[model samples]
Target: MYQLNLARSLAAGSVFGQNAVKCSQMLVSEGKLEPESFNIAIGVAAKMRGQANLRAFHEHYLEKTSEFRANKVVRRFQEAIDSLSIGSLGNILVEARTTRIRPTTRSTGLDEGVRL
Candidate 1:
């Protein structure tokens, strides 16, 4: 079940990431979005590829600008990120928690005599 859920999450994120790029391209072609608007989609795609563990909403800085003056592009990206299901997020959390390492106890040699 865990493997199935993870596969689905990856597939969904892949489709969503592609859709974002396509949407940005369409906007650019239609003159509704500036050429720079495509940068956000590119950034998202790069991050998604590099960090499979990251959720769409967890992607930071979709664009290079310190301040985003374009609301439409931002809105589109937000909508795309928001579409991810809660189950995917839960699965990611479960995977992360399971991989965390527990603290280890100090080992003492038998010849040295252990202190309690």
Candidate 2:
């Protein structure tokens, strides 16, 4: 169930390119998904979106290896990191936030002496 949701979030983020980081962060840190999934999801997000800093990601993952090493379930985590670490991530296009402006409304009250 958790894996399914993680994949769903990754897929949605990859395709839509919105909430990718938030979804990835939630899934990776709290969803309890596989460590490899974390790497893969973050990698895809970085490629699809911007990873901010690949160097930081690599360092953080490497630091976690020893902690997860005892558990054999996360062996593939290294592979995911390796795949994401290859070459430059290339340029990233960030979508700009749009602001909506409300139309101004004027009301002429009984106090017409004041400007509307």
Question: Which candidate has the top score in TM-score?
Answer: 1
TM-scores, all candidates, are 0.23, 0.21
How many clashes show up in model 1?
0
lDDT value, candidate 2, whole model? 0.48
Candidate 1 C-alpha error for residue 15, in Å: 6.8
Ten-residue segment with the worst summed lDDT in candidate 2?
Answer: 86-95
lDDT of candidate 1 at residue 6, scale 0 to 100 = 51
lDDT of 2 by residue, 66-103 (tens): 54443332345444444644222211123235679988
Mind giving the per-residue lDDT tens digits that candidate 1 earns over 1-96?
344345445557575556445545555567755534555545444435434433332334335333343444455665665565433533343345
CA lDDT of each prediction against the hidden true structure: 0.48, 0.48
